[model samples]
Target chain A: MTKNLSNVNQIIAKYQGDQSALIQMLLEIQRENRWLPKPVLARLSQKLGIPISQIYHIATFYKAFSLIPQGRHTVSVCLGTACHVRGAPRLLDRVTDTLKLNPGETSVDYKFTLKTVNCLGCCALGPVMVVDGEYYGKPSAKEIEKVIANCD
Target chain B: MKKLQKVTLTINDREVTAKEGMTILEAARDAGIYIPTLCYHEKLAPYGACRICTVELSRNGRSRLVTSCVYTVENGLIVKTESPKVIKVRKLLLELMLASSPAKAIQDLARQYGIEKRRFEADKTNCILCGLCVRYCSEIKQANAIGFVGRGTERRVVFHPEIASTVCASCRECFSLCPTGKLPSETDGVCFDDLTLDDFLKTQQSPA
Candidate 1:
């Protein structure tokens, strides 16, 4: 947690101490840290002199920022038309069963966060799952278990 | 008049110089190094949402990933706009963005990169974080009626409180800007083909 704060401070410093760059800076910070915590928001508010309420508002308003701690691995399922017609729902169910978590929920051990997306644009490979920045296409229920095992 | 400061930098191992305030993207373009980007136009300020223009820069012997669109050229900056790491990150970013918004435009680009399947399952939700509609309605059209509501994973553009009416003019400015044609309409509720809300908003504006 302290490390996250220090990282936020570094980001704040990169913006030349400007609060207006809050959104972009926070985006970058989140990219590095995976998620933003409330304490970090307070620190940003104090550093930038912006009200904590305003920071909270902006944080809540943007779809990019997350208030909770994210899992170590994030699995995003693509449900584009091609994927949908190709049994993406079945794949989603398999993933949820394998991970034991619902969509948008993280595993109890924080090993994985399961999420579903509209489309990955790779229709040729329906039922795509992107895990920890790695792409996996046309994965079956069994294949997903192998992939998760490989991650471990 | 304030004197414009010049900064010398290296892009793709080639030496080039640019104005201090110039973005690394501008300097690279001037130097003939092409960096792929979306949501970045010369006429508008950099949005940095695409994350495709990320470059690996080594400054003071430390390296970091910086978006070329927003990063300014600095003296002694050694930048590699295209590297193995940079390519990987760009591809991942593209994959993530594509997953969020399943559109023909995104698919075409993904095909170019040989991304056959996203590693994750598909999300049924249609909203992508492109912010094009938000920008058009708020910035270009100056309507500011519909804006992004919700945060992180649940973020979406809707009339406040998910109600039908608030500030939305229903000019369909957002509909046109939407890449997937998934904007909400009154006719069929959430169906893509329904445009009753759009028509109603138009009627409200003209009010014959």
Candidate 2:
């Protein structure tokens, strides 16, 4: 927060502080910071001349932005209709038990953040999980555990 | 001046005439029919959120369920406000909403409809993620302080920490519009456990 406020300003300037670019701006902020801090959002709102509430609205509307600190590796289990039908629930259970964290919660040590997504748009690869933007299709419990172990 | 054109439609078993622009819900109300709604407000613009006002429409050899609050009337239209299919869908929606908030007002309404238990998993907390407060702030007060964020099951009402930290006590307009009392409090207000029927009924109509 002490230094990234300026970084957020640079991203806002790159977007020309346009109101319509709010989503992209936040995405960039998330890209740089991995999660959106309240201070960065306030600074962006001030620079962009948009209401803070409206900015929060946009931030919350999208699943990409995180309001709090996120783990280095994010585990999103696809619970979409296609994945669900293909046994995503079992994958989710296995992942959560191994990670010792539930959806919407980061581990106490911040090693991982687990979440369940409606779909990851890879229906053919039912029961998928993504870690740091890398997709693992048809992941089994032992495979998911090994993947997380290697993420450090 | 042009006369107001009327559309003749059948609601339930009775023939009713309503203005061409009037919605089916309004037309049914004009014909003395009752339709439960969660998001409709006379003051704010129509938002078809709860889907409880859904009714079946049959015309031209086709039948479909449309939310009466938004769907308009047409000539020779047949409407069944309480069709079995409509009830089944409404019950499902109500169960989902009940799982989220379990508000007394909503529970009473559901009980009247004979719904007993939640059929699906409850994935959310109170507030039901309805946008009534967000809409009230934006449209009515123009405050832009709160809003709905995310999509699908992750959708929820989010507040501006800076603004909400200070302005909540002074401005409570959204409190009334929120069907679930989760907003505006960590305790007290319309939260089910905060008070009882006798205390609440003292101020408003008793649902029981």
Candidate 3:
């Protein structure tokens, strides 16, 4: 699917073309376009008067930026120490089985992007599975299915 | 121009005088003290990426390890290039580098440190992530055609195909800066759309 992406100029302009706010501009662009296209990076390089290689460096360095297309929903499973002891791996396996998408991979239909995070800083919610921002604690397979089913 | 202030320091029990802002590596090099380095180049800024130049620094009876390439010289500072701690750090760094790059420079360093083999699994990507090519392009050449991408073990050097195709042929300065020689070998790889420097030059030579 093609996104209009005309708003990319507006996003860059919002930051007043400040080189320091490169990450901020990228984040806003990612939020709007779901991914950073090559042409978009080239456009950003031209507009900012910065090198395309430098922009590519920033895009690839941060975990927040996605060079490839991302799905509508972001499903993250915490695999922190606490979550690990609470069967987070098994929970991740269940989610992977349900979505048929491994960590760092998006679904073909653009429904979900499954990811495994080291920690969410919520130790109380061990083995936490978060979809779109809603956190679930040690959810069973059925609960996982119900949550995924509700997304689309 | 204001006269550059000098600082006196002890390196390997030898008194050495250096400019105030000079790094330990520079001071040592000037004083004829040999300290092995990988990611350090005189033309480029002190990156301190490769820890091979790690040295034992002492001040106020306190000693700690620091990369000499970026660490500035100070009055009464004692630097040890081949201390037990520094040797261990260099040895381990050499071993780790040997696993990935095992190139001439790395092998020579490994041999110096008595590292026969690396204990870690060999993942020979050849490119040591030294940033020489990247830094040379950006700092010296100001071309910015190549740069480092990703973080940690996932990090690698990549070329901007658009910029490289335009600037790299006439300016192959970075080709010689690479310590591991990955640049020349990977020039025709997917990054340049399978276009070699010779191919680029040939196309340039051909009439339109």
Best by TM-score: 3
> Model 2 Cα displacement at A69 (Å)?
1.9
Off by over 4 Å in 2: A72-152, B1-8, B13-21, B30-32, B95-104, B115-126, B149-159, B180-208
Best lDDT goes to which candidate?
3
The residue-by-residue lDDT of candidate 1 on B1-208, one tens digit each, is 8999989998888899899799999998888888887666665567787788899999777899999999988898999977888978877876887666777766776776667668765665555666675566546665444455455665555432122243344456466555555663322322234223233222222211
**What TM-score does candidate 3 reach?**
0.92
Candidate 1 Cα errors over 4 Å, as ranges: A1-152, B159-208
lDDT winner between candidates 1 and 3? 3
Tell me the interface RMSD of every candidate, in Å: 14.3, 11.9, 14.4
Query: Each model's TM-score, in the order given?
Result: 0.48, 0.70, 0.92
Candidate 3 deviant stretches above 4 angstroms: A1-3, B189-208
Clashes of each: 20, 3, 0
Ranking by DockQ, best first?
A: 2, 3, 1
Select the stronger candidate by lDDT from 1 and 2.
2
> lDDT of each structure?
0.71, 0.77, 0.83
Worst 10 residues of 1 chain B by lDDT: B199-208
Error of 2 at A64 (Å): 2.1
Judged by lDDT relative to the true structure, which candidate is superior, 2 or 3? 3
